[model samples]
Target: MDDKMHELEIRIQKLTQVHATDRVRQLISLLIKDIGEKTDASTIRIPCPLTTTDLARMAGTSRETVSHVLQKYKASGKLMIESKIITITDPAFFMR
Candidate 1:
């Protein structure tokens, strides 16, 4: 199916990037993209439905790594997590 092919292609791309870049950066980039796709508004702050563990699985990394990176982002005013819902304050942060 077309959807399956798209998923396969994305997986292939992730595999390639996984080796070429830092996992934390890759994970954050993916998170931003996912959030962007899910949100309907132009607002920068949007609640993310995915959890840290889910993000870790998608990024092919450990939950601890995702947690650590998220903490840094929170400290930097890029995002915050409460009740397992993440809110991206600065969507552009992941781009850098």
Candidate 2:
């Protein structure tokens, strides 16, 4: 019984991680479809009005994780964030 409980715990942890990833993916898709404008075939610009906390709620993830992901996108030059605006320099990056 103890072993079974441990196995179940591990499975739950894995599933939680997967859920978080899925949430982020959903957030990205929503951002793209809801606000993204095509500047060209490969680039999109989004005027994001939502705050990090708002995004977190929308994504069903922690605010820190959302901030971290946004920073990563900024670092990779795939996106830019300024105040309440977000520009997606590489739409292909999110499609993948």
Candidate 3:
């Protein structure tokens, strides 16, 4: 019975992890879609350029995580940061 309970706990952990991943993916998709639509012909757009606090709130993530990801993206040149403003540098960057 203890082994069965342990197995169930592991399964529940796996399921919760998957659900969290799925939610993050869905959120990223929504953000990209919204950004795409807001882009101009210049291939750069700033849609809801938010502070780390606000972005974290929108994505239900930690501000530190948001800052880290945004900085990573900016470093990769897939996105850009001007002061606190996040701009999509390559509007077609995510089409793949």
Global lDDT of model 1: 0.66
TM-score of each: 0.62, 0.69, 0.55
Q: Give lDDT tens digits, candidate 3, residues 36-73.
A: 44556645554555687776675566777767777766
RMSD of each: 4.0, 9.2, 10.0
TM-score of structure candidate 3 = 0.55
Clashes of each: 0, 0, 0
Superposed on all Cα atoms, model 2 deviates from the true structure by an RMSD in Å of 9.2
RMSD of 1: 4.0
Which one wins on TM-score? 2
Clashing pairs in 3: none
Candidate 1 error regions (>4 Å): 1-16, 19-25, 35-48
Model 2 error, position 26 (Å): 3.2
